[model samples]
Target: MPGYSPPVSMLPSALQTRVDAVEDPVVKQLIKDIVAFYDTETPEANAQDIIKDAEVYRGLGMILPERRRADIAIKQDRLVVIVKDKVIAQGDWEMYDLVACLPVPDRPKPTWNVVIANSTGKDPASSIVLTLTDVAADKFIENAKPVSIRQALLDSLRPYVKEVYDEPVLHVTVHQGSREGVLSFLHRYIIFGYRKPLTILPLSQISNLSYTVVTRLTFNIVVVLTSGEKHEFSMISHDSYEAINQWVTDRYLEDLSLAEERRAKKQRAGPSELEAAAEEASQLPEAEDDSDEEEAEFSEESDSESGGEEEEESDNAGSEAEESDS
Candidate 1:
């Protein structure tokens, strides 16, 4: 019944106390086993790397499809998820995929989503989704973006700014069909949040998009999808409406330009190269499903003092906008 105590000892004082309170010997050992998996693995070293060199982007977030909230940090190429100050999940850039700029639940301003797969298991059962504000999210995206494609993406997006475009999200209510939700948009995606899970719409799917000022206080956005599906949203924001509308027009045009680049590239590659590329793409493993979450609320969260309750260390925590559920 003694099993392994080494892993338990390796845990920080606060988490060790939690493990000590467990009454059952088997339960205690099982918890240690999970810890051993992390300690003996690469994540401990990853954390050490953060401590020594890299800066960390840390925040709180929920796991998708499972809906478990935890403390998350990203440093260098590593990301860790902690509950009650105990690390429950951890992985590096190479082990799992990363996605950024996805929509998020109504919580705080300058919010964005950072999703990385839970990499402890071989089969990849779940993902850690950190809903981060701009400071943390920006740091994450800077590292997560692949060097190879970063230049290509900028080249594809027309009128690309040397610096990424910035717009402070003004939380406003929008209606879709029978549902009313908070509307948020980025350069590439639309996220609608309310009582249900956040529904995301990617700009790439839209064939045409238009916005109209209905009254002095309200406006409507009409979207036509590449599939010919049409959707509309009505939102009221006195301060940010025109700015948001203009931003959307600019981004939508950029999206179309990027799409055209893809076509041009394919044409230059010829039929045989397209077939070969399509076949190669098909062999890649599929990403995990991220919808079907419950209600999530955000709060104004500032960074905790450097390191733990006492120590200072680099906290760590980007990728792309996910496609629409509608």
Candidate 2:
């Protein structure tokens, strides 16, 4: 072996601070183990081995589910996952739905974060939906506090923030449970991802969404909405990107056209103040008649004054000639 240097056990100083902050022994241990594993070269460990060794824990079976390490990262300065540099699991940390907070050129912080857990152990074809609500920081001190996404950030940060799709995801988890239910859910999951592009216009424009396997099955869907909402849908479904893209594209265009038509209708019906005023004026009696009457009176007075001046001038000229002859 060429100079096998055991991977240096190191972490960013800030991450070390986060590790120290966690109070739960099991969670702290898992974080430490994951960190250590990431520091090493054993990237081929199976999920079973990783779970049994207390290297990682699942959220559902635990008594304190909040403390359990689920498919995603929660309660840290930042969310990150460390996989053996080799195991290409679908739920690997980097394979997450996150968008950069700022412009790409600036390398801004990540505003939204996501993590997927492969629950193949519990059910060969099942998954869990982890709905994270915004809780107050004060509640976190007592235990957990749930709140809306709107309340999480200050008003100033609202404009720049991006969020997950409004729809609740059909998390296609793989496990061993009711075979009928499992198959049904999988069918729905496949159908939904397949039909989505057809219903969505932006998705139709997408060339494809790719999926591959090294350790775990992963579907990487790059969806673009007609409204320009770009998202990466990563799951364990076996559907190809082309199918997903087409379905999403059709659906998005339909929605976009409907929205545009509604906007145009509202614009035509809702009149402005200026337009309303003009319409009201048109409905009233004629004011131009008053203006015409005033002009007629003024013209008659001018004609009478001119006639009086002409008579006075003739009388003055006759009087002057008689006085000169006398």
Candidate 3:
């Protein structure tokens, strides 16, 4: 009777049964954590509170469900999706490339599809998709006036914008012949992929970036590499094209300004102190040769003086000899 408490009759019969049947230590601990999070004395007695609390626990990876239903929730500024008690996808709102409420013909209500880039992976360019219920999707969108998918993306991106360098702001799907990939701009690199990076272009290595609006529905992105090779990504949406264009233009200008600053600094500083010292060292042999030349001239003068004195002494001896002969 110590651990046993009267079950609340307000909870859905199925959910209450699931909670009562939980025997796994992990699940029990998760329930405790969830109860502590809400600071409620008897969360099990409140069906609605327990269900909402379960979402937070699920998002934090404290619990895993048995089925593959969308358990979407926001925790610690991240949008997380848990499926079968496993974290299927998670990211900051700014990292989300697309989020839309699409109608499912077979289902009674519309389903939300959220696409986000993996920012911390080796293939940071890849994308993950999460499907959520209407309530979860509404929470994910946050209350924005005249709600639209593009508006939500812009709202998320606004927080990351800075005075000097903007956030990695571009999100577009790329199509190359038979292959397709998702493209995203990060703080320092441009990544392309769906699950792994197909291509990673650093900001420094990006030589030329441009985009074209082919039509109201079609857009194309073109990139010119330092090697002079051109790559074109075609068949993009107009809204996506505009977003990419703004991001690329801003980043390109910033990169150019930074490059110019570096060049000017290099010119002003000239060579490094070590390099200048090495140059001076290389000219030391010339100074040594000059010193040698001076030494040689001094030796030549001394030799001539010595030879004159010898000649004078020889003349004096010859005069003495002539007198003796007289």
Candidate 4:
């Protein structure tokens, strides 16, 4: 029987014409092999498995990127890939969501938007010190409506804190009426994987936060991370909200203590040239006044010499006059 014919609609016109025009049997066989390959399927292919296979291809000089980037680690047995400080695996997350209902009497419900800002310094160059900001909608917070912003936040401070400034250090401005919006903004910076010390304080408690000297009302508490990176997290706190705020702040501070120590060491290691120059100047000897003394001594020597010459001349003249009279 003649070879089976493909309908015009079933085959692309160009491909159909090319196949019909093929004069050699060998060329037709090559086209048949390509079609068969295209129709074949691999059973249940996983993307992770395919990526792992491609990496091995690169090892054998198959393909390489123009510029090298970070490599993802692979788990052959589990068919998974691991990136720096992150891992991907197939598993159910529902089981991981189980929670034990241990009673936390002091834990307050999260009421305000978590504010994360940079608090490095007032200077333009320093990186932000992450801080949480809490704004009051009503006098719902306990403890006297935050007499001052610093007072509201300062009392909640932990020992791991490096410095507290009553100014906003963030390069960008963020505001939200709801708590979720504020938290979503903060979530972007939380990937540092370092447990940063958290400070939750009210903006109303601090007086200096809005002053011209400070320029911002956000209270900043420094958190030294174990990774040598400094971050700032701030939020408004009320008396009723203090419990949960305290929990997060304390945990962050405890985890960042090692980073705090490292930061302290780095800051103390070397002094600026200006500071060194000032110290050297303080140790220098005081200047002396020698010009007046030198002038007085030279004047006295000249007068004494002139007086002696005059006396010698007078004595010689008297001797000569006496000899002539005799």
Reference-based TM-score of each model: 0.37, 0.24, 0.33, 0.21
Per-residue CA lDDT of model 3 for 64-152, tens digit only, reads 12224444544334444554443444444445333322222234765433334333323343344434444432343435345543334
For 1-326, candidate 4 gives per-residue lDDT tens digits of 01111132224788878887898989877776564333222222433333443211111100011112222212222111122222222111111111111111122642211122223212111111112224331232234354432234333321222233332222222222221112111211221110222222322111111101212444333344333444443432232134434433444454454346557888988888998999999999999999999999999999999999999999999999999999
Tell me, by lDDT, which candidate is best.
1
lDDT of 2 by residue, 112-131 (tens): 21112221112212112232
Evaluate all candidate structures by whole-model CA lDDT and list the values in order.
0.51, 0.35, 0.51, 0.32
**Per-residue alpha-carbon lDDT of model 1 for 1-326, expressed as tens digits?**
11222335457799989998999999987897676565534454444532344333333456453455554444444545555445565544554432433444455664554434312222233344444444423333235444322222222221322223233243457787778866666556554543344454566666777776677877777877767877787765566667776867678567766568668888987779688899999999998654433212111122243225334222221012222322
Stretches off by above 4 angstroms in model 4 are 1-269, 278-300, 312-326
What's the C-alpha lDDT at position 47 in model 2?
30
Q: How many collisions between residues are there in candidate 3?
A: 2
Measured by TM-score, the strongest candidate is 1
Which ten residues in a row are the worst by lDDT in model 4?
57-66
TM-score of 2: 0.24
Cα displacement (angstroms), candidate 4, residue 195, comes to 21
